[model samples]
Target: MTYTTEIIINKPRKEIIKTFEDSSLFPHWQRGLKRSRVISGKAGEEGSKRRLYINIEGQSIKMTETIIKKNLPEEWHGQYTSKGMKSIQKNYFEALDDHKTKWTSQSEFEFSGFMKLISKLLPDMFKKRSVMVQQDFKTFIEEGKPVKTN
Candidate 1:
């Protein structure tokens, strides 16, 4: 399944990038994300690994993400492996102006073996999952000003 989501933040490019790069900061804004841990290398650098545990379908799945590109204040790309499923995510953040940033995520993956058949039959399910995840981010960025996500 290919899933993607996007949002425009009202924060500066640097501030937004800081929030994205901070592994300990994910649970605060990332919806359904239980936690994130740095697996091996330093974050914001190529080859950094982050282990993410997320809730999906009332279940939890562990995902390991390897940084493919980590250009801060602009873009980040990574490949994720979760439960024998592999996918790649390209996250782009563009500064629309001094006070606005556009955040976009594009992911592509193939579900084979048995899952592929299900994905082919029910595309909306996967898309909805992606939408919910992004909506969490949107809520965090939009609401973090006055309150804490945690």
Candidate 2:
């Protein structure tokens, strides 16, 4: 199954792109992400790996993401692996105007067994997750303040 989500940020395309290219700030924009660390090299290089712990309800899941494609200020694609399940995530950015940016994120996963059954009920699980993350980023960029985490 694939999940996609989009948002318009009231910031220049460069600022929005910086949030994605600079992995050091992932925690500030991603609410579900509990922690992340680079494996291969620095933030913006291809083949760089990031292991993220995401909060799923009251529990946490560990997912390792490897960069597959990189086109700065344009596109980024990665593969996420969690519990032996692999998924592809794609992110794109477009300038809506001088100070506006449109961002879209897509993901496709091969789910099975219990997950397949659950996904049927939760139609927009990843979409919601993406939206939540983007909304936080919107706050970070527009307000110069991140969403408070407690």
Candidate 3:
């Protein structure tokens, strides 16, 4: 499945991108994230891989993240793989003005094994999760703090 979601952040694109690139700040906006570490390559560089542990609804989920593209303040792309799901995320940022930015994301997900069944049964869940994460990031950038707990 594929979809796009967007939000307007009341901050400059540079500021938003700064926060987005900081791995230390991820746990704040990514509500379920438990821990993350770079397993190979230099952090933030294309081809770098990061392992993430997320506690989703009391279940521990693990995923490997690879940076696909890193054109900051303009675009970023990444791929994420978990047990039965794979996702590619393309993110774009546009400066609306001196103090406002527009964030857009195009996400595609493919399910296999057991997740295929879950995907068919609750397709909206993926979309909802994507939007929720975007909103959380918006709140974090605008308010200068994480609104959701990890």
Candidate 4:
């Protein structure tokens, strides 16, 4: 499945890009994110891989993230692989003005095994989670307050 979601951050594109690129700030905005550790290459550069530990509901989910493309302040594309799911997220940032930026994400998910059933049964779950993260990021960058859902 594929969908697009966007959020307007009340910050300049440069600041938004810088903050988004900081892995240290991920847990603050990415709901349920517990921790991440780089396994290969440079942390944020293309071809780098990281293991992400996230607690969703009461389940501890683990996923591997591999950066596919990185164009600072404009685009960052990556693929996240989990047990039965592979998600490709392409993010774009546009400066609306000197003080505001628009962040858009084009996300696609491929599923197999049991996750295929889950995805078919609850497609909106993925989309909802994506939007939630975007909204949380907006709040984080604009107000410096990360809305922790867990």
Candidate 5:
């Protein structure tokens, strides 16, 4: 499955990129993220790998993310793999003006095993999650609101 999501952030592109590129800030916006740690290569560089632990509802999930491209303030691409799914995410950033920035995210997912059936049954779930994350990011940047986690 493939989908795209877009959001306009009320911040300069450079400011948004600064916060986006900082791994330490991820958990503030990614509601369920419990931890993120670099596993290989260099953080934020192409080919770097990171391990992400997340909790959704009552389920614990582990995912590995590998940076595919990092152009900064312009574009970034990453491949994320989990137990039965792989996702390729491409992100684009544009400066709409001096104080507004546009973020566009394209996601492609490949599922296997049970995840394949789930993907077919709940395709909108993936897209909704992406939109939620993007909205969370906008809130984080504009309103200083971090995702509330229990």
Candidate 6:
């Protein structure tokens, strides 16, 4: 499955990129994200790997993310792998004006085992989740709202 999601952030591209590059700020916008730790190479750089722990509903999920490309304020790409699914995410950033920035996320997912069935049955779920994450980031950047988790 492949889909694209986008949002316009009410901030300069440079400001948005600065915040986006800071791994420490991820949990504030990324819902259900518990923690992340670098596993190999340099964090955020090409070839770096990080393990992410997240909670969805009541289930704990873990995924490994490897940076594929990092061209800040323009584009970045990453590969994420979990138990039964893998995704390639390409992100593009554009400056719409002096105060507005556009963030576009293109994602392609490959599924195996049960995840394949789930993907077929609910393909829209993935795109919806991606949009929600983008909106969460916009809220965090514009209004200082962090995703609330229990």
lDDT of 6 by residue, 1-150 (tens): 898899999999999998898999999998989999999999889999999999976879899999999998799999999999999999999999999999999999999999999999988888988999999999999988888831
The digit string of per-residue lDDT tens for model 3 on 35-111 reads 99999999999999999999887889999999999998799999999999999999999999999998999999999
Q: Ranking by TM-score, best first?
A: 5, 6, 4, 3, 2, 1
Put the candidates in lDDT order, highest first.
5, 6, 4, 3, 2, 1
Report lDDT per candidate. 0.76, 0.81, 0.92, 0.92, 0.94, 0.93
3 versus 5: better lDDT goes to? 5
Model 6: how far residue 80 lies from native, Å:
0.4
* Predicted candidate 1 versus true structure: per-residue lDDT over 40-106, tens digit per residue: 8886579989898988668798999899987776788999887647888898898899988888889
Q: In candidate 4, what are the lDDT values of residues 1-150, reduced to their tens digit?
A: 999999888899999888889999998999889999999999899999999999987889999999999997899999999999999999999999999999999999999999999998998999999999999898888778877632
Tens-digit lDDT track of model 5 for 1-150: 998999999899999999889899999999899998999998899999999999976789999999999998799999999999999999999999999999999999999999999998988989999999999999998988889831
Clashing pairs in 4: none
Better-scoring candidate (lDDT), 2 or 4: 4
TM-score of each: 0.83, 0.88, 0.96, 0.96, 0.97, 0.97
Q: Each model's number of backbone clashes?
A: 0, 0, 0, 0, 0, 0
Local lDDT at 3 for model 5: 88
**Superposed model 6: Cα runs more than 4 Å off:** none
Per-residue error (Å), model 3, residue 116: 0.4
> What tens-digit string does per-residue lDDT give for candidate 2 at 24-89?
677777776777888776665789888889887886889988999999688989898877367898
* RMSD of candidates 1 onward, in order: 2.7, 2.0, 1.3, 1.3, 1.3, 1.4
